[model samples]
Target chain A: MSSTRKSQVQSSKVASEQIKTQKDIDMESDEDRNDENRNDNQQQSRPKLSIQRQDGDNTNATYSFLNEDHTLGNLLRNVIIKNNQVEFCAYSVPHPSEPIMNVRLQVAPSCGDTKKVLKHGLKRIAKMSDVLTEKFQNALDKYENRMSD
Target chain B: MYGMEQINTATGFANAKFGSSKGQGAKGFDEPEIRILELSKYVIKFELLNTDLSVANSLRRIIIAEVPTMAIDLVEVKENTSALHDEFIAHRLGLIPLQSFNVDQFNLSDQCACSSMCAQCSVQFKLHAVCSDRDQMEVNTRHIQPLSDAPIIPVQYVNDKGIEEDPILIMKLSKNQQLDMNLVARKGNGKIHAKWSPVATCQMRKEPIVEIDQDKINRDLDIEKRKEFVALCPREVFAFNDYRNAVEIENSDKCIQCIECLRFAQANNLERAVKIAEREDKFVFTVESTGVLTPEDIVSRALQILMRKLYELGTQMKKYGVNAD
Candidate 1:
């Protein structure tokens, strides 16, 4: 009877140890998952933003915005205003990894007194749109190249 | 007394028989009144003869006087030949070298005919020069014509010397050497004199006749006088119409079709409301006198005729107790 009791105690201790070891293994795995998630968050937050000037100052006024990336292109596609006066719409991601900012603008007539809403109001919005589009395409190209590398 | 009376009676009867019988016979004869017909025709004839002695003479005199004394100056040149050396050779041969070729600056006061075209007041210029050695020299110049024929003048200078003519220095004052001579003859014989027609004959067919809004006429007369065409028409035309609110034409037929009304409207800062059309049946009676007359004289005559008609109307109105004022 003593023998049987001692054996049973030893087996229970071993089982407990096994359970503790399992728990430790689970904790380590959870910690590893948390570290991976943190790394992912850091990568997302460090996205690069690019700015490009359309017409490059040659126009009456220049517009600058981030380069176009997936996010920027998506933002541009969401433009709602489609008026006769609205010339163009574009999205720019200043950095390849950054969020995109979409800009909508129009070419105002020379005679009217309406205050321009984009780029200090007086600046021609059409020219800015062109530059933003070019920079966005360039940024996408660069992002593709970086991915390939 | 009886003897005197008998003598006077015999003389009187003889005179009466001779005079009365001849007069009666002349009256009985059916002779055409050709002299009277000719006189009437003469009265209706229109002939114009004009002589602008002063204007023509003054222009001629100015041309003759101003052209010669014109001053010229050298402004620019391009070398094409060695004429400078040839000029030096000519100087060595005791010939005066043509030096410093340039235009004399023209001055009006130096003109001879007092602005008339006379032979005595003209000018000629000669220049001579010598070079130490045989070398090519070029000249470029700009000649300015003060009394430019037209508003703008263009001038160019070129040197036409060849290398073969070098060392000899034989530069001649050819007419080709003249860069630009813009001297305009001021003889006022042509278009200048023709442009100044006598005022009576030069009457522009169109005169402005003001037709105002009857209501506005009285209110705007003072302001209208300050307008550009106040003198374009007579003031009476601005009188009230039947409505007494606006002014209108008093006698539409009396209009001479002068664009005066249009001009008056334009002057008073108004739109062109009146139009002028030709009246074929109403002929313009022009008395072509031999001498010049002022435009005012002709205008006064026309106004006088208008005044006479107005006076007759006024007299009739007075008789009917119509208030002219």
Candidate 2:
């Protein structure tokens, strides 16, 4: 009974045709379901990083980092801008609600690759974090010792 | 920032780096240092010197968002005849902070191999409360008991005199009202939910640089003007010096950059007499923990988490074939 009702609904939708082919209707519904599934997948799984390079320029590029905010964006841009090879570096979150950080980098031709610059900046930031951790630990220890005394 | 070259050339691609000698570089670019100003069990105050604002902000953000702790995430209600709804009780249970020093022993529920929850991934707690004879009864976290013998427990606050304070109240039960439930505590970070955040308040502020020209104030302004200028600062940053008959900075750190004194100085046509600026390289940080972890532990863990994130990004970039030539 439900199938007959569905068919009746389908037929009324396609009333312009005298007799709409059942196979065509089934194929159209299947395609719509597949499109919905594809959209669901896209919404569920966003890639970690997406890179877009200028048409003829390897030195200028924009990188979009998924699940990132000002924490990574500001640090990476600061480190990248400090590098002599970098001509310009800036980052923006694009939208506060979305967890997307876009960083634009333009480097000197001598540097040659923007990805390498980004990787180098990451290493530097990591090293800086290492230093911060060590210093903080030392300070904590000193404070504890003083309190104990 | 100007001494960036010194650090860049320190371990040279080509040898002979700049600022190889000690004590002769830009303020922040020379070295980063930390000084613990105050430390308690739950609160810590520190100064991060010679660091960029971006670096300080990154630390602040990581401490707030990435530090992991154990919190009750899922609750199963067996019988709840209380006036409150099940979801309201479940949400209150989730917000309670558990002692998570041993959080490293458990895996995140999603990362664990368990079908739903297991001993290695989650801690089970049972709460049973009933008001039989009393007109009113209070239900608190103390009534919630752990199913197994794990170190994880609800935070127990202590007063300065080392006395255990009253437990956190969850609800009040009327006559014959009973509540029975099972709670599952899992390891997570603030990014997932604020209940898992280890810190109550993690904040950083720029070091205020307040300058008052005593000589100019003494020469140009009279006692009335000096009193008015001192009263202009809402934070009491300026005090009138009766001896020198000048307006002087009493407590510069109290200045919140209100610019009241600066406006008054400008109105008096005293150029550069009162200046207020912030040290770009210095930041004062205060961290208050939610009893799941100590403030010091939170700071160290945040730095470690940040390092891990950077390392993961680098590896991920390499996996995508972004390696150097």
Candidate 3:
């Protein structure tokens, strides 16, 4: 995804596309599970935005992001780690030549749900990235305007 | 803070308090809220709150001395007719910061499972520079090329036309001088050598503060004298507010604490006119990278390295009945 984006210099399109792909991937992961068990888990709890992990248990979750990651994985790990519920979070590309990156998250049982917290943290990071993109554009515009003036 | 005097009253020496009523580093131990004041590909300025002195110092040290990076470690000089000695050229090669994303595949030479030095432990680069022309020519990093199949090594600077330009001049070659060398690069941390240090500059300074006593200024001296007192600072830390007709500290951080601003006040016998000091707890950190890695990446890797070391220390001390968390 990073190669396709080719955003050595960041752009708004690349930023939004990353978030869009992440959301899409999350939804697809959600679809992989049987609907009946998801219904059971939903009926058991009425909490807001309950994100049940399909391929993971309560302890750990691992997801593969193809090309959508490069340095962003390291950043996302740091972001998710801010939460007290997180026991550990790390992302690593298996090899430099490979486009795949794996983000692994571990949550403490004493805290909240792992999947919800991780998803929420990703959302917050996406929003923060968008805000940073805006700030960068504004600063560049201001510098250009000053130069022109 | 509870000094020696406050220690006698409560439940013996074990219960003596220094922090807030909560406990020793308990309340503020939560994840610090990081605020990015400035950022770019090469340099970044950021602030974080709720950090004690040691934690903040560790971060500064990590950025300065812990981030693992790729640097030329061993150089095999096959032939050298240049004025520079072989050892000097090898040392120079060891200091060049190579641009590449360091992968986990390469290990610190000593820690690698391979018995002999191999590709898993090092990357070989060859430099052959000779002035084929009659005039004098300079040798640069562009002359160095990775002889290994792995293409992890890159020049620090690339022009808009995609041509690579060596950021540093390796040496200058005359008509007859020829410098040829084969160098090996390995992944290592700055803790082992300064050449592996990622960030160009990682420094932290206590946040500066300024205190102004308007009543003292107005009562002791006339408006003209007060303006003179403010302008006495060599750093121009003070600027006159035209609307308020008062001399105020416009840029307090510029204060060098030279006590130059105190001259007029002391001359007039009013010593309380102004004060400048640095906050002991609050620190301003600036990190600049060598373009090998982004400044943000440098900071993140610093934090991760520090945390990993602390974790390792905790785990290793478990035999002595110590817990990490």
**Model 3, which residues run further than 4 Å from truth?**
A1-149, B1-20, B23-31, B149-151, B158-166, B321-325
Candidate achieving higher DockQ, 1 or 3: 3
**DockQ score for model 2, please?**
0.20
- Which of candidates 2 and 3 reaches a greater TM-score? 2
lDDT of 1 by residue, A1-149 (tens): 11211111111122245457556667787787678668758755543322234443311222333322332233222221111223343434455444344343433354121113232221212222333233334443554466579
Residues B118-166 of candidate 3 have per-residue lDDT tens digits of 8888898888887877778888877888887775665476555777665
Label model 2 with its docking quality class: incorrect
Going through the candidates in order, their DockQ values are 0.00, 0.20, 0.02
Worst lDDT run of 10 residues, candidate 3 chain B, spans: B7-16
lDDT of 2 by residue, A33-104 (tens): 678668758966767888888677889899999888999999888767766677778899988877789999
Give the Å error, residue B113, model 1.
55
Per-structure clash totals for the candidates: 63, 0, 2
Query: Native contact fraction of candidate 1?
Result: 0.00
Error of 2 at A13 (Å): 40
Candidates sorted by TM-score, descending order? 2, 3, 1
Per-residue lDDT of A35 in model 2: 80
